[model samples]
Target: MRAISVIVVLAGVLSCRAATPDLRFGWNEVDYVWDSPTQRESAIKSRHFLPEHNLPLGLARWKNKLFVTVPRWKSGVVSSLNYVDIDGAKDQPLKPYPSLKDNYVEDTAKEIPSNSSIVSVFRVFVDACDRLWVMDSGLADILGSPNQITGPSIVIFDLNTDKLLHRYYLKVTDMKEDSFFANIIVDVDNATCDNAFAYIPDLGGYGVVVYSLKQDDSWRVSHHYFHFEPLAGSFNVSGIEFHWTDGVFGLALSEPRENGYRTMFFHAFASTKEFCVSTELLRNYTHIDKNEAFHDFKLLGDRGEGTQASASFYDISTNVLFYTQVNRDGIGCWNSNKPYTPENNPLLFSDAELYEFPNDLKVDDEGTLWLLTDKLPRFVYRSLDSNELNYMIYSIKTKDLIKGTPCEN
Candidate 1:
């Protein structure tokens, strides 16, 4: 009797251990178009199921709520921002943000005051205080025409009130070129009490601009070090991530003319400092030696190689940097090896989790990375077993590299 009991207990223990999850770091899209009546019935039976939106661009998960900002363009019209919810209920559109039409003029009352000028929200973020940060990059008329309108302002909305709080304006015109605010991330606490900084990748200006929440004037605006060479008269910046721990900022450069479509690159800044110039001292403000305060830079690119799509650093855990490489024809991780690059850098993970149309890739507190793919049909999801093969969110554990070890290349 004792031997039989031991065998049963051992079997139970083995079963439990087998159920434990492992980090394979791979995923796939579960094609739901071929679902059967029974499967459809089962999905409907669960209230947690929700419809998926069109191509998703940016993603942010705060607490139990997940926000995805997807931009959709209609012919002869401005793009639209589609917000969605995850976790509690698959992917459901929370709200819709219209695209910005006019941006060149300095008229705030007609633009900011009017709800018609609000463009698609490119990125969504939540501060430590649970305040939602929405970045509306007014508009960029890529196609040359007098009818086209461009926007250069960043509008802040209070999530609790769903009302516009403060508007941060970026003074840039001649939108015919590729110059406009691209991406934004808010750092509420930066050793200087509570503050928020906006990073603007001005492709038209060929540099990165920094703005402070505490500043009310444009004279205080600062431009960081930009050593990038433009390609085909189009050297635009894409994404920006803030590194609070190291006091460094990571900025991504869009593909140059030579590189194929969607190729990506990133640069890092260290020991960043900022100051405000009041309206009274606007004329007294002097540009200081920015290089003296500069420390080091890490370049993630190859003159000729795989494409680097996007990049971002998890604000919660400042250790690792995450970037994306698009694979339309089924290509995998991006390969870049320039001087001062980490040999083991561009750490290639398995393509099992790679999406067909990858955009707006972001990492969360648990090291879990999320991407809004271009292939989400009417709906998408992941089951317990097939979850590993679909859009279901999963936790990831990465081993930190030891001292003096290569992290990228």
Candidate 2:
């Protein structure tokens, strides 16, 4: 009887482990549709479009389109903003979002505060209002040709019409010499969309830049928590090893509390600690010093070693925060209702091959958890063998992701 009971429990565990999500997309290197065969040939000939150099760092889904951002961190990138047809072939070339002319043809590097001026985009956010928020990093070749091609700005598009809505450039005061807006999230009440606010983290600058869509204004707030731990700067993803001092790179906003303000869960890219600050402070912009103080932010404790996260998303359905741990190469989750401890937050799954540097994590409108794993460390320090799969994307229902785990509730 004892043997049978043990076998039953083991079988249950196997079933749960086998519940991996289907691969939505896989690519050794991303390709795109050019205006013409001649243009494609010329771009490659000019060394303007190197397949291996173009890496997708952000992911967002809207209806039938999946928006991807391939930042111009290095040369050979043909398009900085693009999208793929979800219902088309499983493996297909990307189509520049909105139109090809807007992404590549125009000399976007100098077209500041314009729709056609997206030099490079990192991570994007699609709000409940069916609007896609594209945060242009402005600086390019950051790894190889670090240049401020354009000033950092926010380029928003109406997902409903695939048209430009607004373009707000960040003021000089909103940036530090090393500012790199790596990630962004939207705070909006769909019923009243104009009051939307965007929270963008300056991973390289070590601060958070807030923008008000209605006011057409922006501000940058600083805090000690935004700094990365020097010891945590070292990373080993798969077999590639690298060091990055990226601060405050991930952002997740919870459902509004009794005060009608949300709790923003954020962390540095090179640290294992997670912290939270109220949106009230960020949205107010009443005084920078008051909001930037330590008391304004609360430490959620350490997530243990080897859990430096990059991008995170909050699931309203489960009240769980899903994030990517680049060091561990997996996703971890914690129910907001529970304390932020090792016991409360556990690495849901890990795959060195499939998740060899999970860079983006998102919860779509349908309660699905979308994860993008780009072999970033290898792409930066070493080289990603294009012959082998170098980039992968997976989507599993949020409920399925936490099944049988402490976050299940």
Candidate 3:
């Protein structure tokens, strides 16, 4: 009887392990369609084009259009923000958002008349109210001696019309010279969009900036959790060794509570630990300096010994937080209500070759989770083997993945 009981317990454990679903492939070997030949020639004539350096980094879907941002960090600065039609061909051509004529097509060294538009967007969020909030880092040549041409700012546009609505620049006091505004998450009132809050992570400077849409004000919040763990900086991806000391790269917000508050989960890029703080504490700028505000932070748990992540998204429907585990070359998930343990948080999907570095993730309104993997390590350590399909975007049904986990209903 004892032997039988042990066998039953072992079988149950095996079943649970086998129940974790593999991420479904939506698109494979995706490639961006470059600007028209005439447009490229014109851009080259203006001394603002480079063919080899363009790389897609940030991604977000709005309605039938899928948006992508290629920052002016490593190479040319032609079309920094563009989108492709979802219903189009597999290798859909990317068209500039709003319109190509609206953007500054001059040289990268030249300044444009309107700083309000997206100078260089690293990440953008499409809110519940159909507004696209973009984080314009305003930095060109990010790796080769960064320069802050325009101050970092938050810009919002009506997704339906693609018209600019608001632009709030970060004050010098709110950001450091070394600041790299890479990721942002928005919290909006369900009924109204006026009362909204934005959280931007300054990955390079080691802090988080909180922006208030109602007040038109912003503040910086610093904590030890925002800094990277030095020992965790070393990384080995696809047999390439490299190191980065990025801090606070990813942020995800939980569903609003009964009191209309949410929990903010964030983590550093080069660390395995995750931390959380209440949105209530962050919204109260009037009392942010108080010691109580500092003490509200809680360490969730470590991901694993050498695991690191880039982008994370929380699906309110399933109460599951999905994140890109870059080192693991896959996506990892956890039920926010469950204890942040290895057993609770498991690798939902993994593919060393296909998921070289799953850099960004988003949960669309259609109940599908979208992912973008841009062989980032290969791009950085050595030149990307363009002949071998370097960048890929994939999607998986969120409910299908959470079925057997604690997030399941």
Candidate 4:
């Protein structure tokens, strides 16, 4: 009778364990592919076949279209901006933005006018108001000898109508000759698009620039936090070891508080440390130069070695920050309400084959997180395997990711 009771107790425990549902990380589906030679040739020809270099760095979505930026940093390409129709197939070709005639191959002048169009764009941001913000670095061949075609500027366009809304040039006083405006984040007023603020990170100049829509003025804010740590400069991605001194590459904005102000979280590409500052302090330009005014800038914590990130996006509804861990070949997440520690911020997904180097992350209107991965190490240090997909775009539900961690609440 005791043996029978033992067997029944074991069976009950097994049944309880079986009833528990298995938790999953998240389901990522490939939305676009840019790996085949035919695809590369097609994209190159679509852009007028200016320069053979075709590598996607930044991504944004508006309506049913996906916008991808192909920086001229490598081969001085003609069209720096391109878009893909989501309604088309995964292998659909990329079309130049605005128009193919606007991006001419012969217009390779040393200093193209910023008012003409997009000279060279490193990254782009599509706001909630259906406005696309293009961060034009205004420099060509960034990886090689950079040629300043025009001064760095922000070009705003109405995505709904496909019209140029405004073009605000960054003052020369706020930038250096080597300044590279890489990433940008737009902060809009509550329930309105007017009186917006655009924060841009000067990755090469080691500073942050704030542009006000209401004032039509801009200011450059410099802090030691923008610089990279020496020890974290070396990176090993996909078995390729490299050393980069890039500073202030990624930027993200938290949801606005009761006072209609948001917190800005940023990090250097060559460092594992994350830092943040309130937008209120940044908007007040008078005290930005003062050392005491930067007291609000706080060092969140280190993400540990081999966790350097390229881009980050914060979900307002979930209050969770999602960032791409390039070196780890996956994405990591941290709950703003919890401590920023390794235990709290776990690797949401890490795949050696699927995620070579997740370079960009953006959140869309439907609460979907989009990621763009380009095997940058292979494209730069080594030759890309044409047989394998070099560039890929993936999307996963933000709500599903939040459920994978304690941030679900």
lDDT of each: 0.37, 0.82, 0.76, 0.76
Q: For model 1, what is the C-alpha lDDT against the true structure? A: 0.37
Per-model TM-score, in order, reads 0.54, 0.93, 0.89, 0.86
Model 1 bad stretches (over 4 Å):
1-54, 76-79, 97-117, 140-150, 173-177, 190-194, 218-286, 290-304, 314-318, 327-342, 350-354, 375-409
* Candidates sorted on lDDT, descending: 2, 3, 4, 1
User: Which numbered prediction scores highest in lDDT against the true structure?
Assistant: 2
* Tens digits of lDDT, candidate 3, 1-409: 2322333354345446554222222232232344467766766576566544566788898888877877776645666677877776544556777666544433344455574456678788999999888898777766554556677888888888888888888998887867889788999965978899999999989999999998999998888889999989988888888999999989999888888899999999999888999999888856756676677899999878767888899998788899988888888898887888877778876667656788898998888888877777776668765446565666668898777766665
Q: What is the lDDT of candidate 3?
A: 0.76
Q: What is candidate 4's TM-score against the reference? A: 0.86
What RMSD, rounded to one decimal, does every model reach? 13.6, 5.6, 7.5, 9.1
On TM-score, the leading prediction is 2
Model 4 alpha-carbon drift over 4 Å, by segment: 1-52, 105-107, 113-116, 287-289
What's the CA RMSD of model 2 in angstroms? 5.6
Q: Give me the displacement of residue 209 in model 4, in angstroms.
A: 0.3
> How far out, in Å, is residue 379 in model 1?
18
